[model samples]
Target: MAQLEYADGIWSGIDEAGVARLEIDRPEVLNALDGAASARIIDLCGAWARERGVRVVVISGRGGAFCAGADVAGMATDAAAKGGFDESDSRAIIENGSRLVGAVRALPMPVIAAIDGPAVGIGASLAVAADLLYASARSYFLLTFVRIGLMPDGAATATFAASLGRARANSMALLGEKLCATEAFEVGLINGVIEEPEGLDAVVARAAAKLCASSPEALALTKAALDAATLTQYEAAIDREIAGQTRLLQTPEFQAAIAAFSAGSR
Candidate 1:
């Protein structure tokens, strides 16, 4: 009820300017999102969609990093308890990630991602789903799933491919390269990138304010039409990810990586 109560390392609030802000607040893990956090995100987006006063939505993370991706540490625990990552609960996390991206896309108003630092895996996917993406000098987009023995989920395969095309997306998903803010801006992956650190909010605010000044009907219609034109294959990609990631999570490769990560982090 009412966009689901805040908890689970996420924060949501609407400002007087009709801007709804969603902040990922788990800085200790660099804002790694778990299943519960993603669920709350989906609920918050649904609630914002219904609020007439909400004109724009802004998503960002607290601390230096925007989001480090899925809670790999949590995944490690889940895998340990379940004897593997192939369990129903682990698969649920993958499906929830797809739903999270869908929720961001479903928002009627323009959404801006103020990426202040690293956005990896689903975190990168989430940022790319925004209508406007801004980044700080310290920020980078990385599809690190390859390193963890998984492919990009959360519609990253679609959104990144749609935004930067196959070759660039492949560079990230295939090689797990870090696309820095300057490079992202140069390649047109982001709307703007601040050369100075901590100035990302200003850029995002300006973009959100401009959208707020525009006719709500016009902005919403434009976003919908653009989605229709550009994201024609998005839904199919989500389905593909859910199926593929469910299987991949069960693989020995992923299991070994999770084990190694857990040991190394300790």
Candidate 2:
């Protein structure tokens, strides 16, 4: 049964077995995330995780792509409405979305990301935050924040480092390159990859069902331990990212970059 439904975006459901699935529903826009959608997703995930029967949670996107990235249209509209990009606006956007990413990390039960296609920018961050990642062979992880002249937010600065180590994370963040599912699995960024796209659902469902068999208390404790070990690091990374972003947003370099993109100059 469909568990939760919303108008703007995002749909969630928990099966009788207590396995929950949260699907990103904005396919026409390649499931690009915006403030309103992210906020709703965060709220629902938190509430569902707290419920008694929700043993495991799976997050995926509709259509061919997992999530392209932030809604460029929304960002452009917001920036225009506010006169121009400013430090305050950038910080608010980052902080608000970071909270949602953090919420997924803090979920008591296992949170799995099922990526069937491209997962870019903050989408990459969200996938990395999951306890387990199952991706189709065609799926890729792209950190496009740099391409857009924005520093990584969603706690990815730390999450990427922890999952892929310092050098790889730095390369991805600095270069804004796309990493294929196989490459991500090799680097320990993702848990596994399925060769057949059609097999993704079964693969994720089977894995999540296995997780559901474990003691919920034990699962929660395990998640807490993992999170505790990296809490300080994530916090520090978030602070650094926010500060760097604030400075960058105020710079003429970034402003020109945004303007160029908005004008389709590059």
Q: Name the lDDT of candidate 1.
A: 0.89
Q: Estimate each model's TM-score.
A: 0.96, 0.93
Give candidate 1 misplaced runs (Cα > 4 Å): 1-6
The CA lDDT at 59 in model 1 is 94
Candidate 2 local lDDT, 150-255, one digit each (tens): 7888888888888888889888999987799999999898989999999999999889879989999999998889788865598888788778877776666666
Q: How well does model 2 score by local distance difference test?
A: 0.83
Candidate 1, residues 1-266, lDDT tens digits: the string is: 01423588888888888999999999889999988888889999999999999999999998888899999998898788888854576578788898898899999999999999899889999999999998998899999998988999989988999989899989989999889999999998998889876677778888888988999999999999999999899989988988888888888999999999999989
How close to the true structure is residue 151 of candidate 2, measured as C-alpha lDDT? Answer: 85
